[model samples]
Target: MKAWQATPPFGFDALRLIDLPRPTPGPRQVLIKVQAAALNYRDLEMATGTYQGQPQQAFTLLSDGAGQVVEVGAAVTRFSPGERVIGCFWQGWEAGRLSDSAALPLGGPLDGMLSEYVLLDERGVVPCPAHLSMEEAATLPCAALTAWQALVVEGQLKAGDWVLLQGTGGVSLFAFQFALLHGARVIVSSSQDDRLKRLAKLGATGLINYRSTAIWHEQVMAITDGYGVDHVLEVGGPRSFTQSLQSLHPSGQVNVIGYLGGHQGEINPLLILQRNARVRGISVGPRQSFESMNHAIEASGLRPMIDSMHDWLKLPGALAHLQSGRHFGKVVLRITAD
Candidate 1:
């Protein structure tokens, strides 16, 4: 099988096509014939050796992927061969709260799904939503699931509530769509005016051009008639942390899901106390959340936004496209059985 491995110095430039031994399913695992893989910030971080999940020596590249099952282990009955599925991004965190000590995570500590075929614990693979394409489903496990968990699960977002999303990135866009589907008013902020216009067509009730009007928090306040937004799907790092904090209602919820806007800075502790607000640091999510997200996505007939799809031979180019910050949604790489 052909697989990709990340090497330092050149980052993802180390993607060399090479043959590797095909993996067999374990007692509770399933082997999948990978059809498509999706890019995330974590992949870029891993490529540059900056991710917390980076390997010590050898590591598998890429994480989120979707495909059809080729084989299943003896103990696995939930999924049968030939069923289309996607490997969970957080392999150990199956449901509810995360367990501190767990193993065999995909794309990080364990081998991931960035190849022709990959093995996963049966618990780590979920059926793709019936309405989504394999390429669309590949983007769900990490980015989309994380947004779903934060905006829907943790925040308890309700209709008519004002939901704020920063940037036009994958997670933010998913949140924007989910919030819209739930009948919440969406406010999307981006530095690019063109991107803001595009987001408007996607059901955002308001747009904040962060580049032209630096005080986007003020705009959020203005849009909500001074009540502030009810929930904030915060993807900005420290740079916009204070802004996100200030843009919320008195008892608002903010789910910190990414660190794209500079990682370190000082934040006033009084903000939370003064406003009675809650802040939750969000990782991707558990398998149960993935299942719920799939249900909602399938029911609503929502399709994921695809920025571009690259041939498996050009996976490096897709990673570079994600790193450039010019993309509006998930970048996909098409893989095939060889």
Candidate 2:
């Protein structure tokens, strides 16, 4: 089997494609003939030695992948040989709160799906939605599930509620779609006006160009008629956290998902106190929630937005593109199944 691995002094130059013998899965595992994969900001971090998941040894570089179940091990029953599946980000986390960091996520601590073939525990994969292509299904493992967990599973977003989204990254766009899917109004902010305009065409009720509007939360308030948004998908860590808090309604929830902006900034406890906010950190999500989200995607015919695609062998270039911060949505890698 062909695989991609990044070694020490990690970066694009350190990445290499290597060949390894594929093996049979154990009784509780399944073998996947990976067809497509997707890149995330976390994958870029893993390539650059910055992922907080765990210290990297030599490992595969992406967590998001979708493939066909070519062979199931002796005890496997949930999936069959022809079924389409997407690998879970956290292998052992099936549902609920994560009390320990023992189940280290993929793309860093564990060998991920950036191989021609990969093995996963039977419980660590979800069935792909029938309507989505392999490239689209590959995107659901991390970003889409994080958005679903934030807005639907935990936040309990409802119709007429307002959601404040950050830039047009994978998670933010999925949040935008999910917010509208639940009948909620979306107010998204980005430094790029073109992406904001695109989101407006896709049903975003409000758009703010944060680059022009220095204080964007004030714009959020104005858009919502001073009521503030009911939810904020807080991606910009410390630098944008203050405004995200300010953009929320008094009882609004903030799902802390990423630290896209510079990580260093002072956070006032009063932001939480004064707003009576529920600030929660989202760790992608569990396989059970992933399954529920797939059902919704199937029902609504929600296709994932893709910014660009590259051949799987062009992973270095793909990672560079992600690092450049030029993409508007998920970047896909089409794996040629030989």
Candidate 3:
């Protein structure tokens, strides 16, 4: 077996691949033959020692993966060998809270699925949608799940509502697809006009090239006939928070999911009062939400936007590409031979 491991402390250069013994399942545990894993921006933070709630050095390097069960423990009942599956980002939750016990999560505090095989409790694995390939299903556990939680759960977005998507990153792209699937008109913003055009072709109702029009909120207002958007998938850090508030109609909802732009900044407190908008910070989501979202995804036959796939031996190169921010969707690593 092979695994990607991070050396003591953390740094991008420190990530390396090495051979390890294959894992065996215990009671209620299943051993999976990992096929594909996707890279989140948080994976970069975990590599660089900057992520909040980062695990100790002994942990694995990725939190999202999908595979097929090759072995199951004696007491396992929900699953069996030969089932296709994906691991939940949060291992402790079967269907509830994001964090229940101090369990080691894959690729964080626990050994992740960056290897040929992995052992996880049955509760941590979900049946992968049969329609999706292993690579596409691998993109779901984190980025896609977060978008689903924000727009559907917390935002209470409904059919015919207007949604504001921040950029072309993993979460935003998933949000775009999910919003459109729910019958919402989506407005996507990107610094690149080309990307915005691509998003427009993908069913986005309106596109805002933020680099050209710095005040994207005004464009959002215009697109909605001055009513403003009903919900926002807030990916911007503090820099875009104020504009997100201004972009929403009174009593709208903003789900703050990421801060890739930069964290240190401030928002005008009066906007919340004046707009009567509700703002909530999201932490990806709980495992139960993941299950519900998976049901919707499977039924709708939604396919994840995969930017690229890398070989296991070139794992560092994959991380470097994500750091460059040159891709439009999820970057994945092929971990299994089959």
For candidate 2, the 10 contiguous residues with the lowest summed lDDT are 95-104
Top TM-score hit: 2
List, in order, the clash count of every candidate structure.
0, 0, 0
Instruction: Return whichever of 1 and 3 wins on lDDT.
Output: 3
Model 3: how far residue 220 lies from native, Å: 1.3
Candidate 1 residue-pair clash tally: 0
Which of 1 and 2 is the better model by TM-score? 2
Candidate 3, clashing residue pairs?
none
In model 2, which regions exceed 4 Å deviation?
none
Q: Kindly list the per-residue Cα lDDT of model 2 for residues 84-166, writing each as its tens digit.
A: 99999998988877665356687778899999999999999989899999999999999999999999999999999999999
List the candidate 3 regions with Cα displacement exceeding 4 Å.
99-104
| Residues 1-338 of candidate 3: C-alpha lDDT, one tens digit per residue | 87888766679777877777887899999999999999999888888878887766655679899999999999999898889999998887665554555545678777887888889999888999889999999999889988998999877778999999998999999999999989999999998988988888889999998788988889999999999989998888898999999999899999988897798788888999999989988777777788889899889988999999998678888988999999889999888553
- What residue pairs clash in candidate 1, if any at all? none
- 32-113 per-residue lDDT for model 1 (tens digits): 9999999888888877778864676656777799999999999998999989999998887877777562635577667778
TM-score (all chains, Cα) for each model: 0.96, 0.98, 0.96
